[model samples]
Target: MPVQVSPERFDEIVGEALDLIPEELAARMENVAVLTADAPSPTQRRGRTGRSLLGLYEGVNLTRRSPVRYSAVMPDRITIFRLSHCRIVRDEDELRRRVARTVAHEIAHHFGISDDRLRELGAY
Candidate 1:
């Protein structure tokens, strides 16, 4: 069954997860915005009706950005889906763990890491 968590609590959990990232990596993140959504949008669903998307990183990745054009670009976005994450966890502790994992996974995408590579690293 899906666990119930208040919106404020869920946001708190997400914040805590972001805090867990290593300082060296976190410090290197530039022009990035980490956000939370209740759930993935229909368009974001991409026809995967039953699958849960824990998080999504949108915008150009670090490695793909041209140095000359990077200065005026908007911040990259990392959105963590609260409802989808909460639905899969058993309790607060599990939610926390999952949030941390999801945050790391999304941040990896920001750094230009592909899902295939993340899976090989056991981070997917």
Candidate 2:
């Protein structure tokens, strides 16, 4: 039976998913931030209307090189939407799985994985 899960439960699940990331993959992740938001931006509109986006990874890809090193690293953000996830997930278990998948999708982008490759790996 599917039990109703709260926001706190989803947060905890996302946390656990973060913990499960392989050390090598997790190590390459630097200054990467994960957050939960209610929705996407005006620029993100592609005809779909929703209160939240399942996840978002906003950061500079490795292909873009910086000539100078700064004192502080730039912020790399990954936003996960709770309500969006809940819409597709029937229970806590599925939600956690989806969260883990979303994390991998964004993290892969950060790690320089191409969109085609990501799709092949089932990250999309």
Candidate 3:
């Protein structure tokens, strides 16, 4: 079973995880929003079975964008699911580790890393 944490503490953990990202990557992160949600919405869970998502990246990947037409688009979004992550960990320390991993995994998606590649690199 997972451990419980106050919402404020969870947000702090998320912030800390984000801060752990490499400086070069963080500096290059443009028009991207990092958000936290209680859980994945129904639409996000469609076609999945008994699996919970810890984080999700939604938008055009950097590698797939057209240089001429990408400027006017909305910022990409990366949502970290708080309750889902909380429900998958054993303690605060584990929760922190999980948050860091989830954040990195989603950010990789932003960099055009596919799920299969993430799995190959053991980041998934």
Candidate 4:
């Protein structure tokens, strides 16, 4: 039988991954909202290839040398797609691993790590 997964279980897995982030790095992140969606929203699907991005990190690049915005709102963040991820993986363990990897990938973006660098680091 195919392995079944629940969003609650996925949320628990994400929590575990969040706990794994380095403390110093985690400190730099604020307002990390761990949202789980079945698929990319229309807005998320806009302006890109029709294929959906598994996770997204919306924040300022750390490498940029500009004054920080005073909007008081830290950059919004880290949304994971549950259904999309599960469809590509075979079992629960694989699903958990993918969740952890995707979490790291988005966190890398928070630290201004480029996608290429993230791939090189095996976070993708």
TM-scores for all candidates?
0.92, 0.77, 0.92, 0.81
lDDT of candidate 3 vs native?
Answer: 0.89
What would the per-residue lDDT of candidate 3 be over residues 1-124, giving only the tens digit for each residue? 8789987898899999999999999997777899888888988777767678888898988888887969888899999999999888999999999999999999999999999999999875
- What would the per-residue lDDT of candidate 4 be over residues 89-115, giving only the tens digit for each residue? 889888888888899888777667898
Residue pairs that clash (backbone atoms under 3 angstroms), model 1: none
Q: Per-model C-alpha lDDT, please?
A: 0.89, 0.72, 0.89, 0.75
TM-score of 3: 0.92
Report how far residue 85 has shifted in candidate 2, in Å: 0.6
lDDT (tens digit, per residue) of candidate 1 on 29-106: 989999998988877778666577888998888898887877787798999998998889888899999999999999
- Per-model clash counts, in order, read 0, 0, 0, 0
Q: What order do candidates take by lDDT, descending?
A: 3, 1, 4, 2
